[model samples]
Target: MHIMRVIVILFPLLLASSFTDACLAAEVLTLAKDGNAKAVIVLPGGATSAARETGGILADHLKQICGGEFRVIVESDLKDASVKDQRIVTKSTEPVETFILLGEGGLTKLLGATSADLGPGGILIRTFPNAIVLLGPGKTAPSDPYGTRYAVMTFMEDSLGCRFLWPGELGKVVPQRKTIKVAPINFNYTPRIRQRRIRMAMGLGERKSHGVKRLGFTDADYHYFNKAAMVTTSRDGGWANWHRLGGSLRLASGHSFGYMWEKHKDEHPEWFAVQPDGTRDQSRSPDRSRLCVSNLELIEEIARDRIESLNKSDLNSVSIGPNDGGQTSFCRCDECRKLDPPNSRKLAGGGPALTDRYIYFWNEIAKRVTEVHPDAWLTADAYSVYSAPPVLRKLHPNIAIRFVGLTYTNEEKRRQDREDWDAWSKAVKKIYFRPNVLLAGRRQGTPVIYVHKLAEDFRYLASHSLVGTDFDSCCHNWATQGLNYYVCAKLHWNPDLDVDALIDDYCQSGFGSGADAVKSYFLRLEDITNTIAEQQLKITQPFPPAVIDELRGYLDMAAAATADEPDASKRVAFLRSGLEYTDAYVAAFRIFREHEAAGGGRLLKETKQRIREALDNNWLVSRGIFENHHLAVNVATVAWGSWNYFGRYYWSDPSPEIRAKVESR
Candidate 1:
């Protein structure tokens, strides 16, 4: 088994190295001085969405390089003729300069490459002087033909120095070269991890703060997600809308306890959770509300409602959960208690661990639904009190356990996570990790460079039976969080890629003349967080006055470096937006400190105004109302926002209470 594992790992490396050597040693293809080549992008017939999208991307990039002209030939077009003969002959009877083989199927069959041998998301790019063959695992894999698209993307990145940093047109960085050059190239790659999902914050009237544009995320973003199960308009349009571009419409929780109780409490009191007094209570708190899962009738009703709800849309996967809060909200009914054993060993949350009962309930629903819709996948958040793996019974293969991450480096927390993940990996077929990097309220200032820590965590995850990762990377504050966001996106595709070198590429490519200044700015801020700050505190917490001043100086240097170049100047402006937010935050704290020290002074008016302005600015930025694209929800107010930035900043109508008191005096 160990020998087989080594062979599997070394084969791709050997193939890639051989290709690279061959390409480097010989230069057979040449771009005519006239800037045109007899080249065509040949793709699979009756291609899937991934094939069509990738075919278009190859055609577009080829056209750009070939002075706005390139042909795309589908395999169906060459049905009667030999593909080899067609490539060697053209309508003009002149020798065809290049034949760019794309996708799998008839086109790849001409090259004798099969889907199974290529494996899932595996890609092979072999560039001859005259012909370039690109192959991706074909249509058999529905979730991601990640190979073809990632091949095209990596080709552009390696040869053309192009990058899709985040999403949308604005996030893409295309080089300003005028002509095409031909070089021998051979590359074969397969993603180390299977699933890479980024679950951003989304809802009605909410503007996406980071990554893609407002109301739309293009196919470009999907290229970064190979095994992402989240539905999108580009593919799964029935349950999803193009408004937010992409997100899920599946059931999040089995029962909305508040809504259920309001309707059924009086008529069917037995359906409600029985309190310690043996009678049912109808009250609901933010976190403490749950239904009696062990009620046989209740479980039956849930299964019926779930199937009905899922049938409304064609989405294949559903993420079901218990209530909002942690473990304590679980029903303590006699039957419910019979399902869960009291585990004093649980560390994160107290009382009985709920893994057994939750798993049992979820498996029941999954089994029933899958019987009807055989491909249906039922996912549950193994979080809060239910974070531990079920010891009583093995999980159904159709059921997926999603373990949430509270802190990345917390030893005890991660140790518990390791145990849970290892156990679940053995019991179930799929396991997903959702770690909080941005939403955890860390303020490492602009360009949050946690490449070291994130890279470390991802490497560890790859060794385990990690099928997918859903990073809760909400609020794309490019100025402060841009580096972190880019790292997160890149690492998802190839976790073993060198992170520091990637960081250097980002700094130099994104900010040309200001690269050195920007690199210094990010590294210095990272130094403070990694060295000075307490691990327990968030990276977003306010630094001391001296640290704030040091940060301001870094931004000042960055601005000066990019003063002459217009493009770099624009990029520097993005870095400055983060500085502006931080400055306002520091000023607000300073004013409050002075007011408190003086015991009521004229400074009260200024302090209130600063905080109010900061709040208002943050709201505008969060909604994409501001001119700057690289803005974040003011970290100062994230605690109050609670993942609802728009609500906290806009509709909540919160006012400075200190102002009211000062005015009253």
Candidate 2:
């Protein structure tokens, strides 16, 4: 009665319509009150993939709540369909007693909302006793159609207490109910950051042990954002651009160096990076790939390949940057060196700063690409030695600079990162962020958790013109840094969100009764990471004996805290994995030291016995973490990589025991 009494000022004339009159005149739509109520999902005839997905998502939840009474109908087809008992309705012009509206047309028609009212990725939700309307941003914005989808997820999470922790059944938490209830409500939300993405590396195959594979695009994994690492057509036929949708049109990354190397290495060796020795260097760089940035012909070749990709799809941008890895892979030829400013940060002998040539090369390439794709963008990374902004010339407006995340634990490096962000923000018109939170290759040691720092960074950068974010992580990092991963996603979506509240929600939802233990565990890990960073110690370096013991003690405490919660064993195991990994490495290093102090015989036998115990514990930890062997495989790689440092002395020996194991492998 109250809702009917209050007329929406702008919609007075529209209320005269039968549908509006019925909606305003009826009491609230009682879903499943008599077990005859049905939710009618109404969609535009040619809706986007996101619209279809969001509609289905809402319908599925209604079915769960209303006990299987729901119907999905395209708006155009609604005329032929029966709706005698339809309670929840979406975007209908016909005079319906109770109706819900979603997206642009519904919001503008029912609530008198203009396109300018909702910015890109913004949503408006208003509720009456009998009706609800969920409005999302315009469809043209890169994140668009998907922005409405995100609104759906946010609604479920905020109102229904649904939590999608990670991909897969284990990570989804949905509340069960026989009847869905709606209360009067009003809320609006807009993402602080435009781009929220995750790039995971390991396997694309259907390996059960691979977390990324298990998570897939949906299956609980895709519950968060719009972009992913791979590209494919959605089931609804709309584009699914995982990495910078409307941007790069490729499944793989770092093509520039590889393409030039493959095309010119044999015939045009000079087109590759020139070593300090005046010889062509194609193999010995941080990225194991380099390019002759000064070669105009080589730039043309790279541009041509990009054009080919653009022709295949209507991608809004392309990446024409250095290969993945540190930026010490630039050419050292005299012509390339001419672009370097004096007092440049040198790489190898008589070479200029990597930034000097990187900007010049990209500027040249951007010029050519802009001529064709004027509205499109060209992306480049400011990483490692080239992390600093260019000193000489400003980047072109068409160029997008991705400021890769640098050291988080170290104070000086953190300051340098902010400096880089500030300088580049001023120099480049478009900016995208790629934060590395992985401990891959030799950097694998103690797991680092920089939750506070990550939140701070996101908040700080949101003030700048940040277009998007792609969080780069290894397989183990994602599982081990579970809390950090959750926090990062929330911050990217809304930088102003209370991070402490998010962290609390994550620990409670993830660990349940054992939340306190898990929360303390991560806090301790962050403390140790900060200490290590402050001491200027690399995680890959061997820990001091006392530090190793302290870490082991923390692991024991975490294990004890979750020991009683057997149901949460998987989560607990994943949480403890990084520590376990570090502990195993420490124990191995200790054995190596013992061997150094004493020759073979009894010491070797005893150490081997201890190592066997450690290995056995590792398998349990692995199963508890990933429920499979991928983490074990990753750990094995770390061990073998460090074998020469210690493992070879014992594991590789020709003695009977070692020889038998080696031969079996």
Q: What is the Å distance of residue 546 in model 1 from its true position?
A: 3.0
Q: Least lDDT summed over 10 consecutive residues: which range in candidate 2?
A: 235-244
Per-prediction TM-score: 0.74, 0.74
Clashes per prediction? 7, 9
Report the lDDT tens digits of candidate 2 across residue range 1-665: 32232222112333343144434354544444444443455565677766776777766655544455556556565544322242334344554443455565532354443335555666665555455666676556554445556555655555545565554334445555665555444556556566666654444333322322322223233212212322121121121121112222221224355455555678888777777677785654533467777989888877877777667866677788677654344566788878778877654454455686688888888888778878777878888657777888778888777778566657777787788799888998877787665443323434667788778878888888787776675443444555565676666666765666676677676676667766776776777677766886655444556765675565566566667765355666654556666665566556555665787455556677666555444333432333342332244334334444434434432245533553465
Per-model lDDT: 0.57, 0.57
lDDT (Cα, tens digit) per residue for candidate 1, span 1-665 = 32222223323334346455545775545433355645666676776666676666655655554454666667655435344632333344434567666766654565454456555566676665456667766555554555666555655566555555443333345554445555666667666666666655432122222222221232343223312313221221111111111212232323234456666667777876776666676564523456777787777776777687679866776655666653334577879888886652455445767788877788787778887778777777777767777768668787766767535424456556667667777887666676665654443233344567777777677777776776775454556766776777666666675677777777777777778888888888666545423354444444666777787787677778878866667767766777666654444345445666889655445566665665544443432313234233323224233324324223233255633443365
Cα error of candidate 2 at position 416, Å: 1.2
- Positional deviation of 583 in candidate 1, in angstroms? 2.4
- Which sections of candidate 2 miss by over 4 Å? 1-41, 44-50, 61-108, 111-116, 176-180, 205-255, 281-288, 296-313, 324-329, 346-352, 368-376, 438-446, 474-479, 540-582, 590-665
